[model samples]
Structures are given as C-alpha cells and as structure tokens.
Target: MLKRVIQQFQLDVLATSEVEDSHSSTVYKCTLSNGENVYLKIPFTKLKYQRELEAYEILKGKVSIPEMINYWSGDEECPGAFLLSELKGKPLTSAAKPTTAFQVGVLHAKMHSTQPPSEQVLNGMKNEFPNWSHFIDQQFYSFAEDAKYILDERLYQKAIEKFERMKQQLPLSDGPSFIHMDFRPANIIVDNEQVSGVIDFESVRFGSTEVDFSKLYRDFLSYDSSLYSAYQRGYNSIRPLIDLEKVLPFYRFTDAFNSIGWCKRRGNQEHALFLEENLARLKKWLL
Candidate 1:
C-alpha cells in the first residue's frame, strides 16, 4: 500500500523512512519526482493515526510546521493511515545551539496565540493526564513494581508525596491555550540558526500553555542554565514574564513520569536512571 501510494504520488527515490525509536508508528522518508522530500508516518493503531492527521491539519501553516501533502487510508493490505509531508531540516536535538532554547520559547509563545476552532478542540489538546500524585500512584508506581530492579522505590515514593503536597500550594491559572504536549528539543528543526520547522504533532492538545514549555524546559534548559536564561529572554520578548519557580516542579515531575514509562516499554536503562535522578530533583525542589 505504501509503495503504491508513493508511486501514485510520483515519488522517485524512497529515502530511509525506517522506523525510529518511537513506540507509536513506522515513519518513512520519501523523495518525490520533483526533488521534493516527504515523510510518511503510519501508526500502529487507527486512533493514533487519525489524531496525528487531525493535529497536522490544525497546525499546518499556523506556525513553522511541515506541510501535510496527503493522507491515505489503509485497507486490509495497508492496515494503517499514511501521512505525507514535506521533509524539513534536522531536529534541534541534533543541531545544538546557544539560541535553540530561546527559539523554542518564542515558537511556543506564537503557537499559543493561534485560537483553535472551538473550546472543545482546545480542551481536547490539553494534556489530559492527572496531576503528579495520581500519575505516580496509578502510572509510575505500577510501572516501578513491574520493573522493580530498574527503579528506586524510595525516591519514587518520596517524589509522589512531595508532589501531592506541592500541588495544593502551587499557583493556578485559568488561561488555557494550545499546547504542543510533547514540545521537546527533538521535535524542533533548525536551519541557519533559525527554527525551520516543528515536527511531531501527535501530542498536540489544548491545555495550560505551561504544559508545552515544561517539556522544553526539562529537555533543554535543565541541562544548561545559560540556555534557560537565553530561552527566557526570547520567550519574554514575545510574551511577558513567566514564573519558572511555579512551573519547574510540575515540569520535572511530568518528565520523570514520562521517562519511567519510556524505560519500561523500551527497556532503556539510561532513561530509567534519568527518571530516577529527575524524581530526586523534583523531591528536593518540592521540599
């Protein structure tokens, strides 16, 4: 089905679109007859495929995002939807920069400015996951028991307790906006020191604008203070100041829980370790 679709699209050479490490889908890169580069993503499930396609359509041309050219439904032979989009530059993870952090901050600010079609669409886009306590009790702790040896139970329990207490004292905001729930460095593309494009809209949902920045801060700024400062400068250039102290704990907790899930599914020891370390850090922050 993919081959036929590529042929129908008049593609010349199918570049390496082999599966990446994502647990979701099989992604491919194809070059068309006119030297146009395109990415084909086929998810493991029908729901995910539909969600990603909807997200791509919603996000197309709103910000610096790759253009979706076509979508193909799967028959018994294909078994999944096919997403075709123009291949853009490298992700920010590969193209490190002193300004990458700031670029992301600004990008996110712009993304939040675009209003979705309805409040329902906006609500659907928000991270629907519960707060840290529920996430730990239902998700992380269960996973830790399943992967006992890989996790630090004491630290996990401490972090969970801390999160529950901190959640009450944390500041609350009712100003909801479009959030790229997985706004991390790897999903951002850069060229000539500018963000050429943003990719991976699967996690695109409506929620607290801060939810989007959380992943960015955890993935990039936590490693380098200078980058965090630079990112703030860029972000503040567009929007006003954001209270990092209020948001950092939530961001760390979210990232830690996500990392734990990743390690459990993929059996990645490094990710598990990172999860533990982040959990400990969150605990200290809450304390």
Candidate 2:
C-alpha cells in the first residue's frame, strides 16, 4: 500500500511507521527523502474518505487544519488515500490543563462561527440536515433500531419517550455552522500547552454547534467543571456561548445511545466494555 501510494503521489519516502491508534483508517507517518514529514491516510470506508477530502477543500483558509498535500481515488486493488502535511505536537490527553481546554474552546468557536462559502458548499457535505432537530430525529430513531435488542424493554420504551419529549422542549438551532462532529482531546494537537492544530476531519459537517460539545463533555469536560467553565469563557471571548445548559443533557444522551448502537453493529467482543458503558449511560438518562 505504501509503495503504491508513493508511486501514485510521486512521493520520495525515506521511511514510514504505522499509527496504531487509527481505528477507522490506516495511517502512516512517512519521512520523505527531502526531510518533509507527512501522513498517508487510507480510510476504510468511502463515506469517511469523501467527507475528509471535501472538508479540507472547503475549509482551506477558514479553519486551522492539516494541509491536504495530495490525494488519490483508488481503483479495484487499492482504496482512496490522502497525503496530508503533518500537524505538529502530540494529541491532547486527559492530563492537559484548563488553559489547553480554553485554547480548544477558542478553536472550536472559530469553527462554529464560520459559514460555508455558499449553499452549494453547504449542501455538498454529506452530513448536512435542515436543522439540529432533524438530525437528532434521524439519528435517535435509526440508532434505536440498531440498539433495540441491546436494551431491555423498559429502558427502550423510556428512551423513545425521552426523545419525543426532547423534541418538544429543545430550542431551535442557532444556525448552520461548520462543526467538527468528533471534536475531542485526541483529535486536538497541542505543543507546550498551546493547540497547534486539529486533525481527523472525516466527521466534519454543517450542523448544530451545540451537538459538537456532547462528545467533548462526555469524554473530558464532565471530569472537571472548572475545565468546562474555562472552555465556556474562552468561547464567549470570541462569540457568546449558546444556552448549553438547556440542550446538553439531550445531546449527551443521544451521543451515548449512538455509541451503544454502533458497538452492537460492529459485533466485536473487543467492544464489550464500550457497549456496557453506553448501556449504563442510557439507563441513567432514561431514569
């Protein structure tokens, strides 16, 4: 695969090492003969590949992201590949300080404030919907179908009822904005406490800005209220923060529910722990 990528992109590679933590794609850290370092990513699915390429093209100057150096649409023997300029620094971990979260918040605020160049660009992204509620409706019911068997009868019914109630009570989306659907510490690159770049554009989309916060809160912010407050402060420094308190519970619940359904569909024992975790989350939400 690396040899073919090198030939197709005409890259002079000196050495390459695989990134072990890349779950949805095969990523390689390639050091070129001329001393430039780049990432060669080949996504496992066509959807992810298309989203990443479109995101890079549309967000070239609007956001701080890895540069897309070159790309190849694969044939029968190979899959599509993207050669991206390396974003410096390590992935932000749980140990990162409140200041780092503030930086991430500022970066995220910039993304949320950016409007697509035109309706054509907005419609081109595969993940856009009419509004926040529409997206949630689609996701909740579809995931419910996948997770029906995973949850007991009482819990499943409670989830349905909760979604219906949430639909009536949730506020209208502020407006369509560019969002990193999977924004989290792992996708954020930081050097010496400053965010250098954000990576993993496969989930980029035009949608509700508030929904983007669900994953970050679930995996990071919930651990420390101080971090959350600092993040909100940073975001408000750029633009006013949304009424997050009103919508967070609903978004967080849906995010957890989606994870459970995704794990069940993957049908791997390796996902057992994740499945159990989301199941517990659902029960808590339903209660």
Per-residue alpha-carbon lDDT of model 2 for 1-287, expressed as tens digits? 77888789998889999986565788999999999899999987777888778888877886678999899988786758999998889997767789988988888898888766565543236545465676778878888888887888888888888878886887767657888888887788899988887888777778778788898888878888878888898888877888998989888888888888888787738689888888889888888
Cα deviation at 247, candidate 2, in Å, is: 0.8
Encode model 1's per-residue lDDT on 93-198: one tens digit a residue.
Answer: 6336668667877787777765555643432243433342353345445655544444467755665666567666656642345666677777777776778767
Q: Candidate 1 has what TM-score?
A: 0.78
lDDT at 73, model 2: 84
What is the Cα root-mean-square deviation between model 2 and the actual structure? Answer: 2.1
- What C-alpha lDDT do the candidate models reach, one value each? 0.63, 0.82
Cα-lDDT of candidate 1: 0.63
Best by TM-score: 2
TM-score per candidate, chains pooled: 0.78, 0.91
